[model samples]
Target: MAAARDRGVRLGRPPAALPEGAPRAAELRAAGNSLAQIAAALNAEQVATPSGRGQWTKSSVQYVLTRYDQERADDG
Candidate 1:
């Protein structure tokens, strides 16, 4: 473990990444759109969800936004 750490190898599940529409969702949210509205807009734009199989839901939007915020906070 020490050797791996010295080699800069991260040894756990990788951090969650923002999905394709995450930035747009953040933008819509910053513009005061509700989570439902953001999800609908993402659907209207045919943006793929993180899973790339299902439609965007309010919960998914919230998840993406929370992940996005966490990433930003970590970066700063």
Candidate 2:
């Protein structure tokens, strides 16, 4: 959902799930790769938080993986 304000637009929810590095984490995890490896990949890719500041963390990786895992589990 979106709303128009005097300043412009505002989002009701986050634009997307996780962050840019999220897909890398999921891809590596699905390939049986390590979290550290995923972190390195994200760092190399310059993925950051929603604020566009700071690097991706291990917890973020875990968060994405867990969300994806749970979603798939729920889908079946």
Residue 73's lDDT within candidate 2 is: 81
Instruction: Report, for every candidate in turn, its global Cα lDDT versus the true structure.
Output: 0.94, 0.69
- RMSD to the hidden true structure, all candidates: 3.5, 7.6
Candidate 2 at 16: error in angstroms?
A: 7.7
- lDDT string for model 1 (1-76, tens) is 9999999999989866679899999999999999999999999999999988889999999999999988899899
Per-model TM-score, in order, reads: 0.80, 0.58
The candidate that wins on TM-score is: 1
Candidate 1 clash figure, as a count: 0
Q: Please report, as a residue range, the 10-residue window in candidate 1 with the lowest summed lDDT.
A: 11-20
Residue 14, candidate 2: alpha-carbon lDDT: 43
Candidate 2: lDDT over CA atoms?
0.69
